[model samples]
Target: MFRIFVIAVLPLFFVFSSEIFTFLSGALCPSCNCESAKPLHRIPRPQLRPEFLALENGTDARLGCEDVGYKMHVFSREPLVVYFENFVSAREREHLLDISEKIYTPSTITHNGGQTSDRNTKVRDSEVALVPRTEGVRCIERRAREVQGWREEVWIERLRVQRYNPGGHYSHHFDWSSGRGGWGRVSSFMVWVHGEELEGGGTEFPRLELRGDKKKWCKFIECEDNLDGEDSKDKGVETAEDKKGAVFKVIPGNAVYWENFRSDGTGRGYNETWHAGLPVKKGVKVGLNIWSYGRID
Candidate 1:
């Protein structure tokens, strides 16, 4: 009887040991296995600083994080701007694409003859991944929040990767929701992964209306002319201050950060921020979209 009891106890000990081993190795999880498992058909979540959340929950809200709230050391209400020195590391970037391949099994809409498009702006329909990196995203979000002077819990509500094959382009659209039950998305950031010489696709935002004919302003700002040409006037032209339109490009591994909410926090969308992706004339464009949501308890 004692021998039989020992046998059963040994098995239990082995099982418990396996559990502990998995925990220590960060390998096996009943609900998840970070090593083998990956996020599917969805964007990655924003990397939030646990210490920031703790600080807000703890006393002394005035005690601020040296690098947490404001972006790039500048506080502005219009929108915090940040440079993408390096968005993803070489190893992690490769892993991201690999995992994305598992979950990003493209449909007819995603892959095509060198062009892909997600016509639906709805987040639920779009593919995504739960990326485990946050260094780049956190930097942008904290700065945007500090500029806005709002005290809301910021989290990455959703992240989706969209690939535009050669000649692919998403038409003009705004990033903000159309006032559903969700209303706290304050801003967005798109970090570029691979950089190349491409034509036709530049993020174009509406320019401020001029006093006289809008064409006059467009001619002055000349952003539309910068990408396309004077012949593409039908695209609707607005003059921007020193060409501050949303349409932009960055080097490979560089990021482009933009805030959806203004500093006032009234939740008003920036009319000037209206933007769209022009048709890509050449080469593929792969980038990450990190959408920061307002406080969620």
Candidate 2:
């Protein structure tokens, strides 16, 4: 009876073992996420109010609209700890501009593809905008305090203002530095004090590489100079006020924002952002930039 039972069970055991072996040996498999790669459809531009971009629906929603692309506001879980205010009185605006002008003092200048510290660049004087945070003005410090969980010695790290002149452009470039000892910035921000209607000069973010795609590049086109050899000053991204400009008028009085984060939680922040400033074809284009460094000590 025992021999007969063994004979009956052996066939069933062998059959089960074969099935398990096949699965373990990769005889059957499922698809992966990397099979195909394509660029994501552009996000729709968000509606603009007097100064601030409407934050209804979602913070990830688009804000400014342009011919090439739209501007996005990126914050953590809550609404932006950082804010853009064009509501300041004329007197207050002048005061802030004055403070920036007073703190600027050029320590170095780099031509061509040469480089300099953001600290050094912040010191230069330009007719457009000023970026200063030395003994007196610590805007970056004040801003860092506003962000939750960002308690640390507020280091201006590096501050700079771009005095975009007619025909002058920073060209297509990424804000992240490639130096041996880089800024190691965890977050970065910029505020455009004045708006420009100058054609041929608008910010653009090219489609990003997703899935299995390998190419990732963005370009800023300084719209071709006008027939007069000056900026046609076509409207820059539309704002909520319904005002626009041509040439070098800064009437739009708005701000733009972007972060270097990917959708799937892979590469986020500085590593993935590629940007540039289009050539200024008419009047001066001024902008203030703030770079935040991760704690070093």
Candidate 3:
């Protein structure tokens, strides 16, 4: 019986010793030259230095913007569409509407063949106002750049505010231009400044397939029951009912960010990024567009 007990306990001791050896090997400081244990000393608590205190206060102040209450939802991976909740502050939205009250003019779109034209087309029926780059607008632009993972603000274009009435809508078009300029639109951030009582007026992406639960995304996107039907091959120039894509609702203070270029280093526009602004069926819808150009990263 004693020999049997010794055999059982000996294996237990070896297992415990192996675990201890592993722990000690990981805990030992590699830079320490001496193998002997050093004498224990009472280390004083670190006092708050002037610079350390200043840094702590500065960090708290910098984090104040985080409490504004916003959430990000990735709607699609390819062509990269992201939905943002409460992306704009109430003060910012009010300021934008107040400043652009009387400046709206008829909106225009680039020709389908990429030619410059002066003729008014029926494709886009909204009025657009170019928002001046004020301090507040610049702050919003900085936030948009940060959300798109861009470090520099030089790639951002001037903000354009669009006010859509019941019949206003913009047909499918690519934001990136194949013009002479070396820079192309890499991403777009469209923020809903108004649209509390509005209906319809959702941004639609025709080629993307919706994934996950329909009920959950219905809060931000206009998910339909019948999406199995094929979309129009003519680049979504037809009405909203004719197109079968992910349509994001126009919610106030919310925004949608999407990458326009392909991730395969070709720097060409993704064909799936073709989207349209659906017509507003009820009240008005005010939205702000912030386009980012140049290297996306």
Q: TM-score of each candidate?
A: 0.49, 0.43, 0.67
Candidate 1 residue runs with Cα over 4 Å from true position: 1-77, 105-151, 179-182, 208-246, 295-297
What C-alpha lDDT do the candidate models reach, one value each?
Answer: 0.46, 0.37, 0.70
In model 3, the runs with Cα more than 4 Å from the true position are 1-67, 111-119, 152-154, 179-182, 224-244
Off by over 4 Å in 2: 1-92, 100-136, 139-141, 148-155, 178-183, 196-200, 208-253, 260-272, 295-297
Query: lDDT (0-100) at residue 98 of candidate 3?
Result: 86
Summarize candidate 2's per-residue lDDT along 1-297 as a digit string, tens digits.
999999999998797985665455432321112222222333233223322111123322232212212233222222122223342234333444666665544334343323343423233323433344332224333432344254443233344555555655544445433222222333455545444565444443333222111111111211232344443445344321222211112323334433333333222233234545555567656565555443321
Candidate order by lDDT, decreasing, is 3, 1, 2
Question: Candidate 3 at residue 216, lDDT?
Answer: 82
Q: Candidate 1's C-alpha lDDT?
A: 0.46
Clashing pairs in 3: none
* Model 3 TM: 0.67
lDDT of 1 by residue, 228-273 (tens): 6553435555434333444455345555556664443233445544
The per-residue C-alpha lDDT of model 3 at residue 274 equals 79
Clashes of each: 15, 12, 0
Worst 10 residues of 1 by lDDT: 68-77
Which ranking of candidates, highest TM-score first? Answer: 3, 1, 2
lDDT of 3 at 95: 87
